[model samples]
Target: MQIVFYARVSTDEQTAAHQAKQAKAAGFEIDVVVADEGVSGVSTALADRPQGRRLFDMLRRDDVLVVRWVDRLGRNYADVTETIREFMRRGVIVKTVINGMVFDGATTDPMLMAVRDALILFMAATAQAQTEATKEAQKAGIEHAKGREDAYLGRKPSYTRKQFDSVVDAFNRGEAVAAIHKATGISRGTIYRIRDNRGQAEAALARWAA
Candidate 1:
């Protein structure tokens, strides 16, 4: 049975590498690492993503598929739930690194199955809600910057516009905050500050001619 580590990101090879290392640390020997870059878990269905399609093709009965979290599989509640159930139906074991959660189709007890299914629903719904909240926050941040454009310029930037944009792109592509910081040499706080308040930071950066 092949053990696969799947990641959804902007195709940063490092992300897959990181996941592989994580799985190893958890004592699972990975046979392959798959990733689809520039894909949004909120909008893209699993089968439609490039590497996602490959994952479907590759997984077989008894194969183990590992992800960082349920959110990586999808942010839509229905889609996430259905995808996981389908994989389990096919005898593919779904495992998460976050809590070492396991979803196996081998259980025949109806009550236990219902409990597992309910947990899947809860996690998927929470993931979707978090995605929506993030979108709302971004919108609010942009709107907040429209009237007071100069307010954000008061502070000295720890990173330049080029550096900030690079970090933002990686972050948007679903790269981990720590990975982005390490790769770009940007502090974690600055990367998040620029990401959460992109409009204000961008406007201020432009005004300063950065």
Candidate 2:
């Protein structure tokens, strides 16, 4: 069975290496590392991420999927629990490095299963609530910033429209979407749009540039 490690950070400045090292130290023989950077966990759904989608496609029956935490999977509780259930149903084992949480589909004890499900649900809900709170804080900050545009000036852009364009170009050239994501830190939805409908992505990018 293949062993996979998935890590995510919301900013490009962060590296997944720390999480990778922790997983390795935990004795998991990781065969692949799928990571998403510069993708907001609170704003982007797990399944909608580039590396996240790749993980879903690459994982196989009996393969062990390791994550730093349930929060890495998603910020929404329903999405997080549903994602875990879907993987388990596919015969994949879900394991977390944090707290050593394990969810396997082979469990026959009803109580154990119920407890596991409850914990997953609870974690997911908490994540969603936290995300919502963050969004509210951001909204407040932006409104405050609007009153003082000059004060917000001189701050570096977290990401640029040019970087996203390069990712789209690479994708259009038939490069692997996962590879492009690893290199460019663009969102999966953007990659999908570029792959499925180049015209739409270009138009969206034009708007972003404006």
Candidate 3:
């Protein structure tokens, strides 16, 4: 059975690689990697994305699909839940890098199944909530920038220009937030803020003149 690692953006491609590496380190072998760049999981359904569609079509019974997190699958709770169930129904095993969570159609026990279903719902819901929170924070940052332009410029980023650019490039290449943070010593929030808000990040970088 083929093992596939999927991601959303080019930067997340790195995340996909990281996941593959982690899987390998854990004794799993990967056969393929797919990613869809510049797509928002919050808005797009899995079947609608180009690579996402390919992923669905490519997977076969007994194939394994690896993701950095449920959020990479989709941001909406229903979509995430439905996608996992569909995969499970197809005999495909869906696994996450974080927490090494596994979801499959292997159990017939009603209690066990119910517990698994509950976990799926919780994780998917948490993914959706995190997406909403990120968007809200992005909006808040922009709004705050509008009112306090000087303050925005004055605030120093935690990373130097060289450091930030390298991190940003890593992100643009599809690295996971956690992986990038681990390698560069940058905070996860800063990484997301830089990746999601390039204009603002660059403004801050210009102010630093690093």
Q: Which has the greatest TM-score?
A: 1
In candidate 2, list every pair of residues with a backbone clash.
77-124, 77-125
Native-structure RMSD, model 1: 5.0
Model 1 regions lying over 4 Å from their true place: 11-14, 150-210
lDDT by residue (tens digit), candidate 2, 93-198:
9998766889998888999999988888877886677556434533544554454534424433333545644554344334577866776787766667656754
Error of 1 at 209 (Å): 12
lDDT of 3 by residue, 68-148 (tens): 778788879999999999999999999886667889887789998999899899988887776565455445545555556
Choose 2 or 3, whichever is better by lDDT: 3
Better of 1 and 3 by TM-score: 1
lDDT leader: 1
Off by over 4 Å in 3: 10-15, 149-153, 159-180, 185-210
Local distance difference test scores for all models: 0.78, 0.73, 0.76
- Model 2 lDDT-worst window of ten: 201-210
Model 2 CA lDDT for position 18:
72
Q: What is the lDDT of candidate 2?
A: 0.73
**Compared to the true structure, candidate 3 yields what TM-score?**
0.72
